[model samples]
Target chain A: MGETSARATHVQHGSHIDTIESVDAVFREQRKLSFAYGAVFFVVTLAIPAMSVWWKSWYAVPIWGGFTANYLFVSLLYYLFLWGLSWTYIKKADALDERLSHMADEIAAATLAAAEGGES
Target chain B: MGNLNIIAIVMVIGLTVFTVGLAIFVRRFTRTTADFYLAGRKVGTIANASAISGDYLSAASFLGVAAAVYASGLDGVWYAAGFAGGFIVVVLFIASALRRFGEYTVADFAFGRFGSSRIRLFTVVMVLLTSLFYMAPQMYGAGTTWTVLVGAGMFGLSPYQTGVVIVGLIIMFYVMVGGMKGTTLNQIFQFWWLWTAMFLVVVFAFTAGKFNYAKGLEEVTAENHRDVKTVTVAELTADDAALLASVETAMSEKGFAEVQAVVDAGDPDATVGVLIPAKNKLHTLRDMFFNEPGHRYNAFDQFSMVLALVLGTAGLPHILNRYYTNPSGSAARRSTFWVLVFIGTFYILAPIAGLAGKLIIDDAWRAGLAPANAAYVDGLLLKSDAIMPTLAQILGGEWLMGAVAAGAFAAMFSTTGGLLIASASAIGHDVYEKYINPDAPEARKVLVGKISVLFFAVVALGIGLGIPAVGLDKAYPALIAMMVTWAFAVGAGAFVPMLLTGIWWKKTTERGALAGMLVGGLGSFFFIIMNILKQLGHLPSEGVLAFVGSLTFPTLFTFPAALLTIIIVSKIDGQLPKNVDEIWMRIHGTASERHEKELGLDKVSTMFGNSKH
Candidate 1:
């Protein structure tokens, strides 16, 4: 029983450290990923209208089914663009939260100091 | 049209009771100004998302877009595409930002930034005017639908106008009683039925109908090539011929001459009548899409529409009001994201149904289910707004038609409720609370909101029921777009400019903000009036002049002008209000209480958090 307890303690320390490390790693990675994702999203959305313009009826088949397919294709791209952005946002949300919280702390300190000085 | 089928009647009645009951349940939440105007700002992401979808998709999307598609192929899908794509723009640039501002109404945001009561009052008048313009069309549509379905004229009033009154009353009641909470709950329910009914109708129409597209095309092609007057009546369908003969005989006996009574009475150049076939309608369709004097259906039109949709979403007062319902900006973002999902799925199916509708009518036309040239109007098989009603009939007969009719009512009511509520809040809370009675507490403000709702509803009813549809069908899209644009301009010019500057730029002055809003608002107004004048033949369509004129100068001109004015004026002024940074911190910060706790801040934090730096 004593041997088991010692083993468990060792494992617990290892896992806890691993989790904390992963959290820090994620925050670091998110800083870079957010910019990259933002760039890609901005590009693709800008491209859709551009393509639709440069080549109006690029897939113009005389058939109704063909037209329907084109419509669905454009709509699917739009939906995918939206969902992808939301996913990217969610992924970096933790890092964003931390950064924003730090900014809030600074603003709060500065404002409180000003208020106290004004009163004096 | 008065012959309501059992299925249609059941569906209609069931939906009516369900919606009314839903309204009653939600009414309990509207006891405070916060509750009435913003659903107490505690609504969940999914709930708010669904409600926003309900509010956004009006009678136009639910009924008119599909009908337009069914009537005119391909081109109608543009409306759906443009509208759905607008939400993407909202998600990217607008949703979270608007939520962060924490205003009760759009005008409040404007005045908050500008610190000018005068600017706020101008916005109040603009809001009322824009809301009325949007409200009138929905009321007109609702009335027209009822008149067709119930044959309301038999009760003495015109069927079209009576339909308007009934729909207007229901919308008013719901808005007045439940406020935003009521409107939100009711919309969530209606959106489901609207999608389901439309989906079922589309599927049924697709599978059950005698649709042979190739044959239909051949028949239309043949009809198009030949002079419509000289078509050979098929000799094989003797029984059908006899039936037609008997009907003609009966009509003649009833003192309606069956014989040739001026087969071509009006000038051939005049607008085509109801009995005209799909072939004849095709001419108008081609002309509308490709040959109209200044109608640009090319990529430029598509892009402009997308731009409108993207920017327009930001400007919509009703949509802005919805963001206030969520507890946090994150929740607002999530809700908006969900709304895109829900709306995207529904819009995907929308065009399919539209195309399917076109197939159904074209097929039926080929089979001679109608008169050689007759179109479906109000299910009487006349050529009018037949695409929607006839498609419903073709899909599931009278039952689906009834459901669609009910859907139409739901669409009208849900949107009108949102508009009325927004308009009411603008009058009741923003204008009344801020300037009229600065110390009116929250409960009194809520009461004022309710009264405002009632007043607007009565006015809606009066205009909807009493004012005859003056040139409704011919100018429907133009009118709807024009009014809706005003709302957008208010949002874009007044609210968006102020909020963006106030939050992001430290050098934004009150005077600059006010000037920006006026420029933006007045610019949109001017453009809108010009468009209207051009439409009414008051302005000559000088090709390049009209083309340049149509670009929403408010977006291009006002946005930059406002930005420039704010920056330049703020620089010249050389001073901002004291504690401006504190206010900026508060507005930019998360929910004040949580934000305070997170930062381990105190009472000073609340002031600093909301104060403008």
Candidate 2:
């Protein structure tokens, strides 16, 4: 009887808390990857204006057409940046879903605890 | 409108049936706010990517860019480049963050970030202003199509007015019943059909001119530079004999003298002229490029043009709101990445289509089969905007013309639907919920939102119809682009800085947020006033260069000013209320998945304590 009661109590314990904590490691990794991606994005967004300045620079030699090589180089860089971001987003999203499911559990647990405390 | 082309009528009926069918199909899926707004946030990357592309392409991209290119020359490609690059900026900087932060709308983000009722009210106003401007042009463009294709004068109303009512009513019906789900499904299908039609039209145009493409282009180029060829004008008299005598004398004497003198001088660039017809005069393509009367490209203006595209993407509320529809922040991010691919691919085809139109028209003119060839200089692209419509007529006759017409209508309708929804939600949900009826039932609140949508849709339709009555039909795109820039400038200047700071910075306060939003909003508003002045002839062209040109540093100028305003005001107001970090974390840290599932209206309402019972 005592063993049965202990199992019931365990089942009724903070299952959500346990689930969320279990995937904390994955969330940590995802966060790190997201930040890295963010940094790259910030750099590329800045590059467009940077190239605008580069386009009018007096000292650069014109390549192919009248446009300097910098214009084409920047365009190619942006394209690659986009390609890289797309690749990373797909790979990282799989792990992110696991993290989010855990987060939902945590939110549920916290809400339950707060309700219990309010009633008490 | 008795001039209603049967093909156009058929296409419109087809579109309505398709949209209604989708609405009926998706109705079962929508049970709550989440369903209404985000499609239950379960939209897979590919479908969502296509929908996003459909939404982003707008009338501006579908018809305007190609037309602008066809009408103008190489310079019109700037529009295409700026627009396509906007998607890249969206994918990288803003989409994921927005999805992660906001639950229902952008106003939800504004409210959550600052916990200020004032900020929510301020944001709603901005939303209304931006959405109205964005929507007006789409409605106006629809009117133009109706007039040109279907003929005018229905029930004592012009074609423009009839078009306004017809499109507005149809769209409102579908949107009211189906919401975002309806919009997405219709947009995706329309996108597919539009793409197919565009592809066929382009292929047929190019194939028709296969052999002639090369020869025609060379001849057109030669003809374009015909003004440079050596020729002389003899100043014709009224009588034929007098004109002939004058031409002969001029050719034998002064013309040869001037030609010999030029040869002796050995000026490589200068032309030595011989006698020509009395009416015809020499002109060069180089002269048209450099000396043609209009705004020439300058480095800063060019830079600002690009900068507007990049920064403008960050500020568009309709685009920002799409992120919230995804199931997770990562999914939202992934969707944006997919959008980059979809948009990039679609945009690449547009230039090819533009080129095809260019070649086909040139061929027809060279074959002496076209009557209008004499109107435009040979080798010069006619209005780039006319390429699609002209190509449609060339390849498909009345049937293809009808299809192109339908595509244009779809493009305008879908974009208008998205913009209207965003505006209504901002006003009804944010403004009314916080201040007007804080304790209102969920059903009542939704009713108000619907009413707002109806109201705005009507207002937009009215303005669209009215614009044509005022004779602004021909200038719609340029006017729309200009106003859109104002919306972008304001959003970039005001909302972006405030929201970014609120999310990322710990020191942001209610006072600072208020001040920043005001300054950014007002500064852009003032800039728009100057733009309007220029458009209306109150301000001279020179006045614009002096005053408005200096403020092209939209974000850079407004950012520092808003930052300073916020910091100073906040300091004077003293410390902010407690629990700021917790609230900030609550908003910023919510995963997209949790929000996605709760995207249902019931769940969202309950989250905010909506008393459904």
Candidate 3:
């Protein structure tokens, strides 16, 4: 009984520390991904104004049937890009969360196993 | 009212009644606070998406985009683009995470995340301010619609004031009774009504008006390409004089005198007439849709407006509240995707409506169906906010006008309803339940919510009635869009930085969030108030004051200030909340994990809970 209690106490402490580290690591990675996505989006969206200001003639160039490059990009392409980025982020973020959850469960199981082994 | 206007009035009244009836029908289902605020968090993906789109497509979008395009051409189309692009930001950074946070209001999320009543209190203020700013525009739009459609006062009130009070009362009733579920249902219907009405107008314009899109483009482009010469006596050579003689022969005595006076002036180069190249006889689409910046925006203006819209969308309390209606984080993400799809489709139709309006007006002028003098057209120009309604009258007569009037009303009602619910939730759920009466019964909380809705409606109505009297209506030609953009700018400046940082950063202390909100909120408010003062002629009209005033949407300055303040203050106050990890876990975890953690359920049971079976 004494051995099991001591082992349980040690595993609980170790697992608690591991959980915090894991959560932080996962969160950091997610934040990095979010920042990367946000930066790319910002650059792409910023091009609308940049083109309007510095490259004035670019807006006049016809890219599609009766639509100028500026018109097509501003009206349609940017929205599609935003949608695509969001879709990709959701997919990847969901997968990351799933992996984190699985890792947490495994750690919890290992801690429980250590306690059981001490009891045996 | 004219027979045609009476028909439109009837349609508007019918729509209001139908919507109120729908709300009453849905009231039976809303027993709990969850149902009242978030429809028990059980809304389906498509329904919620539809509701979001409905809530989003305000009077500004329904009518203002069309008016903007008609007036400013491609520069106007940027409004639609920026609005649609904003949802992208929401989808990426806000939607799912907000849903996962599991809060009734944004203030609730702030309180939960920071564990601070002060932040919650501040959040309530910001949320109410944002929602009121948003709602006021819809109320203004409703008034505009009434003036154009009815053209008279009612019960000793001007048409504008009558419209404000009537719409306010109806919205208050439905929102108080139906809550979020009814609002969502009504919004979906409203979106469809708007879409269908717009679609019908486009179809009619194409079929009846014989709108040749390519030819129209070519003609407009060629006309714009022509070298314009001022029609003055000094500038007029022999050929120009002969052309001016022909133009004078066609003009009435008053018109001829107006032109002659310009010629008589010492400044003979007065812009009496634009001289086009004789070879540029053919009209093209490009000429009609002049694709350039100076018509409406300068370089800085476009960037500021776009930035406000993109960031402001995520910060909007009403929009964020829609996410709370989703069952799970993934569902919120899906709903946002669907919202993009729905709204993207809606925005594409707006410019088409504008193009159709232009063509109709032009054809009317050529066919002698319109008034002979330019003054009437000038009057119409002053009320450019009424372009959509005027177009409906021109293209499809009274019945079509009625349909469009109804659609416009729906747009205003749905947007107002959403804003009311959001404001009420902030006051009732966040402030009243949390701070005022912590142990208040669910029913009492809902009663408070209903009262808040009534209070907000009255406030909005008062502002709407005052707008025209204050000359704000005349001051802003695109009144609906301008007011809506102001709200977006304020929301972006105030809430977006804090929301993004709270969700993504662990070191975001309550003090940092508070500082961010105050700086951002007050900064945006200061700029907006300054601009208003400038408009009222109480401030300088040139230099930096004019430049700042000209921004219209000041998110460019305020958003960065708020974000920087949050970061700096958070770094200085290095103490992280004790429950940061738990909050992160709740926000970032999978459905099964969150369920397990929240309910203290075992993994197997959580797995079962997550499964379809």
Candidate 4:
């Protein structure tokens, strides 16, 4: 946990610290980003099967030579979407981690000072 | 017996030797428990991603998937898509937090996050169950592959039994000796070999076999799909020959003539294999087609199977165990991203092999050029699991068939090796070190871990042998893929809900998570066993019991019910851990990674001894 003290109030890793307030901030931002991507993923994934059952044209009609939209999507195109979704998600997630790492330092210092002032 | 394919056998033997040799080579570096379990946590992003893909792509992906597509059409394609989508759940929800938590195993995560021995033991049980669930299919693949490659048994064991026992023992010995470091290295090497093998099959299909994806689909779908089955003479005649007459329409004159010979002999007890018109499960009013939906599953199963496949991936302890081997939270995400890319491409290729099998194998069968070792009814393989090797034999001759045979073993070896590690840690690390002997020496712990591997390998071997004995092999059209989905269903029920709630929902109490796991895990197991019984004719066809038993994949129900149970139970219990904030910080905090960043622990170049992790 990178914890230095017995009390579980804050985690200290060398010169850096993580107060509950700071982590809560980072968590909210992360939850937003992750859940947003998660929503898209679940929607897109479940949509294919939903289409298979309900949309006859999607499942039955051959758009390509022998390939129905369902076959083409499931066999080949779905993977393209997966690669695209995951690649963009990773880049965004990495960027979020970099930007938030700096913000966490600042937030930790401010939250710690405020907590100390309140205690005094 | 005299006509055994020497080339395929030699290739498989060569692969086993190389795998075992690699494990032995890494044995020296696997001294510490950390090294044995996590490769000392210094694995690079790309290497770790490849290992995860190897661990994730079992015989189910290498063989079962293509076989499924060949038999079930678009429904089979869902397996590849679902397997790949599973990592999305990992990346979006579990990967970073789990890595940030930096625990040894999933059981550790449960204990660490929830703070109780009860939940920890509960998680351990779930882990073992899921691993065993996963192991059963790999063992089945081993047996099936052996039947295809070797075609004979040693020590009076049947070909299937011989395959199960030998492959199980080989994996057990290697995993015990090599540990995680060995498993990791071997997984990377094995993954590339299988990936290349599948790639070669598809490439050969296009070039030598003159297979075109669009044209092939159109050609195969020109007629309604047909199914092959073995039925006793009594059963064939019991329905006033309605079923037998139906079979004549689907079978070729040559194939129907063979069926006629057995019936003409007037042997009531005689069993004959025949081809029959397939029923469209989804669209019962229409005929089943090769390139369309409803070849295998109905409308409900279309959704349930997808959920089972996608959600079940996250629940697999073996796959989740690989994430802990990554160097950092971001590295874990990167590893997962690359994992998606690698396996994504591999999955895309698997279905092509399945589709290719339809065209190439059928042509070969008509020309009398199909492999002699494989049994066929009306040009369709009696056993779809034989499609990969059989198709390869027709397309690229003996060498390609040899490569495919080796690939099948590699898939089983890499996956089973990973499962053994997960199972060992659940028992050796989670149970033994923590509860049985908290202060056990590192060497002793490692020994216990190896013992655990040996025990589970034996159990898995028994399950594989018992599958055919208990009539499970006859209960499903595609046994390997179906059985693997049972594991996925169980894992999806047992783990995904608990992990999702435990990680994302702060109010989640120990009682809630445990209850959720029990509901999801055992609920899935019950439905699966019931379904198996129904398929085996042990259950009546039209009752509540039958209704529940008919759910091929229970994840559609179990996942939601389990999630709701967690929410409801946690709300009622309302007992968060005392150090919830500290735990939350450990899970979501950035100070440590920042600190590690300054110290260069986040680098892809970090070596084993230099790292503090």
Which candidate achieves the best DockQ against the true structure? 4
lDDT of 4 by residue, B1-613 (tens): 6248888888889999999999888887787888899988889999999999889889999999998898888888888889998899899999989998987899999999999998899889988998888898889888887887778889999888998999999999999999998899899999999999999999999999999999999998999988878888887788789888998899888888889899989999999888888889888898999878887788888899999998998999998989888879999999999999999999999999999899889999999998877888888998898899889888888899899999999999999999999999999999999999999988999999999999999999999998889877766777888888888898899899988888888999999999999999999999998999899989999999888878888889999999999999999999999999988998998888888888886776532352233
lDDT of 2 by residue, B1-613 (tens): 2344677668767877887788777766655555566666656666777777777767666666555444432323445555656655555445666776657777787777777777878887877776776677677666656655676657787766877788888777777776677777777777766666666665666675462422432332332211212322322323543643433443435444555565456544654333322121111112322111112233344455555555666667777777777655666767777777766655545544554566666566556543231222343232233455556665666677778777777777777878877887787777777678989875677677778778888888888777756544333223434445556667666776676566555577888888888897777777666645444446655654546844433555665687678778777876664655445334344432343444432122211222122
List where candidate 4 sits over 4 angstroms from the true fold.
Answer: A1-6, B605-613
Model 4, A1-120: lDDT tens digits are 343542477888878898888898899889999999999999999999899888999989999888999999999998888888888988999899888888899998988898899999
lDDT: which candidate is best?
4
Candidate 2 chain B lDDT trough over 10 residues, lowest sum? B288-297
Chain B TM-score (each prediction, in order) = 0.78, 0.77, 0.86, 0.98
Which residue window of length 10 is worst by lDDT in model 1 chain B? B604-613
Model 1 / residue B588 / CA error / Å: 1.9
- Give the least accurate 10-residue stretch of model 4 chain B, judged by summed lDDT: B604-613
A54-106: candidate 3 lDDT, tens digit per residue = 66466665544446777767656766786788778778777766676567556
Docking class of 2: incorrect
Off by over 4 Å in 2: A1-81, A89-120, B1-5, B24-31, B71-75, B209-297, B362-386, B469-483, B541-546, B549-556, B559-577, B588-613
For each candidate in turn, the TM-score is 0.76, 0.73, 0.84, 0.98
